[model samples]
Target: MAETIEEIASRVRELRELSKVTAEEMAEYLKVPLETYCCYEEGKTDIPASKLFEIGQRLDVDMNLLLTGEEARMRIFTVTRKGEGVEVERRRQYRYQNLAGKFLSKKAEFFTVTIDPMKEKPTAYSHPGQEFDYVLEGSLKFYIHDHEIILDEGDSILFDSSYRHAMEAKNGRPAKMLVVVI
Candidate 1:
């Protein structure tokens, strides 16, 4: 089942409180404006997965805990069968499936992200680390900092994620991509 933004926001708030971290502190940690972070905590704005992952790191919790309200327990390899990964519905135009949600102490987070065609521009986000994306189906226009690159099926890119980046489908069709965040 797809978790609602409100449910995720509530969990974020709960986790923050349980960690004894204040909203102001979280905003500082995330390097975002207090009001913007407040909007995320209040469910007024959708929290990007990258930002949520950062929050999980800052709070010392598994990212799955924020996405699925479940902690990863498997310390070794975990096998996720087809269509069995955890689905995260953070935006109307995108679907994120956590492929390694059951793995513990993961060095990199893996997800299969599907971007639906939209007339409205997608928002760019950046955090400290590296990101890799491989086009699995359809075409995608990747916006990294000031450069724009187009990728078709079987194409891939890996780069520093500290620079603002975002991707959207091309030709008004949905694009499926495998995303790995480190």
Candidate 2:
């Protein structure tokens, strides 16, 4: 079914709550006031398309998935051409609300994320879970528990998510990483 703006807003709110991010925190992340962010969630204020996309990225969900309940699933295949290659195909599922709710429902949760280099620093995702992040591509710097770690491709780290954490590309290049919560 085609989704409406209201549905998208509601889902955004759901995901935000599931992420255990308070409205005040979100407001700070968005560089807006708490009441303004609250209005955006309540649908009292219309979110610009650009800002909407930003929010989706921050939440690590496809903009479409947030607009619609349907998830984005794809089969990605990779092949190397140097004769020392293997064909690798994997199914990836991007479920915005579903995954958010799953993590929120659990005492501990995990996430896999990709950040666009053009965007601002990602808002911190916090909860009672322990989180591990492994950099897959590009460079990223993580701010966790008031400490900063610059991660290059293939670098990995683990920490408690209950403490504040945020991430940004260190070299102005897009970053890809896997986050596991437990």
Candidate 3:
């Protein structure tokens, strides 16, 4: 089926409800009026690209996901830092296959993400937690719902992971990012 603005808006509204965040609160987060925010969610008004990007950032969702409703989940493998060189833990694999959901463990969560230049757009994941991401190399386009931000080498963004969000490599360049969810 062809995608429609209303569909995107409705999905976003559903995600917001799932997050247990109210429209007024989201509006506060976006620094927009409640009515305007409602209009975006209701699809009564066209969302500006930049504003949509802001909503994505505030909601912690991937702009593309919000726009296309496509799945971007994946299985990521990485080595534990305390180990010699690399030790794989089958249980600790990072799966972006679904919503990260609530953190079961109080301990810190970490994931090593690698983006290939030729790969399709990455999926968006959101949960109720805090996150810190540091770029190891190259550049990435970070989308928290409609919001898009670029991070170069050594750049980082720390924010609540509860927002719907996703990330992608810019210019088809390979990028590596270390994500810590707490």
Candidate 2 per-residue lDDT, tens place, 77-121, comes to 222232221111111211111223211123332334655664445
Candidate 1 C-alpha lDDT tens digits along 1-182: 57778889999999999999999999999999999999999999999898998999999998889988988999868999989898887677779999998999999999999999989888888987999999999999999999999999999999999999889899999999999999
Clash counts for the predictions, in order: 0, 2, 17
lDDT (Cα, 0-100) at 38 in candidate 1:
97
lDDT of each: 0.92, 0.59, 0.61
lDDT per residue for candidate 3 within 87-130, as digits (tens), equals 11111111111122122221444556656554556556566567
Best-matching candidate per lDDT: 1
The alpha-carbon lDDT assigned to residue 146 of candidate 2 equals 73
Candidate 1, residue 57: Cα displacement in angstroms equals: 0.8
- TM-scores, all candidates, are 0.95, 0.48, 0.43
Candidate numbers, best TM-score first, in rank order:
1, 2, 3
